[model samples]
Target: MSKGKRTVIVTGANCGLGFESTKYLLSDKIDEWHVVLACRDESKGKQAIQQIVEIDQEYASRLTFIELDLADLDSVRNFVTNFNQEKLPPLKALICNAATQAPPNISTTKQGYDIVFGVNHLGHFLLTNLLIPHFAKNDEINSIVNVTSDTHDPKNGTPVPVPTYGPVDKLIIPPQETPKRDSRYATSKLCNILFTYELKNRLDKSDEFKNHFRVNCFNPGFMPETSLARYLDPKLFNMIVEGEGKKYRKPIANSSRYLADLVNPQLDKVSNGVYYDGNEIIPSSDESYEVSKQLELWEGSKNLIKTETDFIL
Candidate 1:
């Protein structure tokens, strides 16, 4: 609630890359960001703020924690409603940084979509679409950063299985078999990239958002210390890393700094639908660039979420 400063919402801001990225953002004195830590748990969100405040107590006044459960569509809607009602600075950007890996067995979100795909993609999809209308509150260019992964491509030589994309209907139904956790996780990441491009494309056609928004895909690379790796079965983990933990690996601080730079309000460079591997802009998977697949994923995801929640367009 800092006056004359812009606001940004960092989802899953309580921990991991999200938490560190928020820190880097707040460290920027030029933009002076008033960040909304969009977290699912109130306690965890407060803990994250306390840690940041310990580093610099001045951050306490600038940080606000808003409850958001991306696993549930209803919660996503409620978040927007609550956010709009509250008297805060104008929201200038949205960083969809929350994500979850696949479980040992089949699981579904509260809205019945596959859990891995649900939280990683669908939840962000609905949240992004719903928030678009509010983004026009600012005249300067805003950002939409969707955190994806390099493992979505087999060409990257990740030890785990490459992503596999099938019909949209089947994509939402979690498979009953085991050992597919790695593949499921990769596809969810792929969905993130595809959604990123399509949404940017749609926003491009409208004068209202012609050059007002920059939507991009970000791959944080492999960070061994995150909870994302800890949840995996040890045997599967060994299989995925191939006994080489350093391959495709990056320290969390380095990756989070790159993420923070993408939306730094002071640096108003225009980058739409661009993919970032750690700190570098690079080519993404062949599967991610297909216009056919991108539209299919966009429409399919829209159809599923629109029924359960209100979308802006």
Candidate 2:
């Protein structure tokens, strides 16, 4: 291992935007920037690694994957523990890109939570929380990026309605699966924003961590042929991307490039608790920054995890 590499962690790196971003980041030939590919599929991840190696053998060592499943809490916990065992230096960037959406059938994670809420929201929430301490070592510039969506804005192009059905107020994942599509997915995306706001507040209030970390949420925008596409009915997926839907879905490679550029510290000033679409941090609704909702999401996550892990805030 090079003694002077800048390390970053990217989740869901096996395919689509995550894969493309990893490939670009690794191939950019930036000095000493090791890209740790956090992925759910070990086989696909290794294949990605092999492809990268074929392109540039020297970059292979700089890229590696840690098996991770965003839907499972125990899996996430084990990932963190194993990562800590490696004792890599403080991470420079932590991108929460691993997620799923709109399963035709309602499903739950091993932890018994709604799959969409569990993977897209809670899993990443808990993962970031666990890794915060590891990145809180007074690094000059540390960032946590939650790959969010424009759906959080109800007034946007697609007015996907997010249902209020979340974990019970006390924060229990009901055994019954919520039966809906757009609403459930939208609500979970909203939770992404809420989680970022809540995390930013928590980090800001910390004595040791205040000013040491930055949290930003972003919408990578719509991309076609992503793992997310697998959930959509095949015919609809085809029609939207290739048929009439071409206008709505952009190329996955383009989306990934835009997202990678946004994460680049070179062009953008660090803004904690901000939301970004491409590069610009747009204004969100009052509800997005609502203190009460932030607290509710935070408390609810804590209840589900049922862990006493300290967040340094």
Candidate 3:
């Protein structure tokens, strides 16, 4: 790895938005950046790197892959340990882009938390906290971009109705009774916003982090072409995408461009805790802005991480 090059970590980077964002980051001044593809599958990660190298030979040496399974807290901890051992350049940005949608049936993660919530919110939350020290060491402008969705807002009223976010206990665990699969997915996305809001608040309040760090969330809008809908019934998923989902659906590249812009070091200024729809900064759901809910999620996340991963934030 280059000693002085800026470094970034993109989770779920093997395909879709993550892949496109990685390509954009490496498209110019290739040698000036080192990108770590944090993927759960080694084979797919290697394939992604190979494809990028073939297209952008100038930056082939700057790309690397590291295993990261967000479904398991132990795996997240291991990823951090392994990344620290590499001793690469100071961390510049962390893009929490990985997410999962469950089938009609309720599923649990390896640690027994709801699978969607576990991977989408809690996993990324822990990962960001663990890496803050590394980001703090760098004086350059640093950022954390959480890839959220417009569906987090109940007002979207597309694909399916989004459920209202509840207390932390319900948010983290599978309900005693199974909820509609789409509701679970929507709840997880809402948690993403709440987490990002709380994180930015904490960072702003901190003397060490207020000026050095910026945390924001992005809604990629709807991208029906991606594998994100793989868990849905094939016929139904196709029907929705071809019909109602078609109008709002954006090309994966468009979503990536929006994400890439957020993390671009060239950008002059970025506001903390802002939510973006494509390139525009917009207000999120009113519920997402509730300080009470944000703090509840924050405290609950800390407790979960401490108990599940034996790591204190």
TM-score of each: 0.93, 0.88, 0.93
Candidate 2 positional error at 199, Å: 0.9
Residue-level lDDT tens digits of model 1 in 1-313: 3532778899999989999999999988888888899989999999999999999878888898889999898999999998898667778889999998876554888978888888998999999999998874466778999999988888988766788885678889877654543587889899999999898889888877777888999999888767786567788677656665567778999999999989875675646789999877899999999999999998898889767446544
lDDT of 2: 0.73
* Candidate scoring better on TM-score of 2 and 3: 3
Task: State the TM-score for model 3.
Answer: 0.93
Name the runs in model 1 displaced over 4 angstroms: 1-4, 177-181, 235-242
The 0-to-1 C-alpha lDDT of every candidate, in the order given, reads 0.85, 0.73, 0.82
What is the Cα-based lDDT of residue 166 in candidate 3?
Answer: 67
Q: Model 3 over residues 235-280: C-alpha lDDT tens digits?
A: 9888988898877788788789778778766676666789998888
Candidate 1, overall lDDT? Answer: 0.85
Q: Per-residue error at 222 for model 1, in Å?
A: 0.8
Of 1 and 2, the candidate ranking higher by TM-score? 1
Candidate achieving higher lDDT, 2 or 3: 3
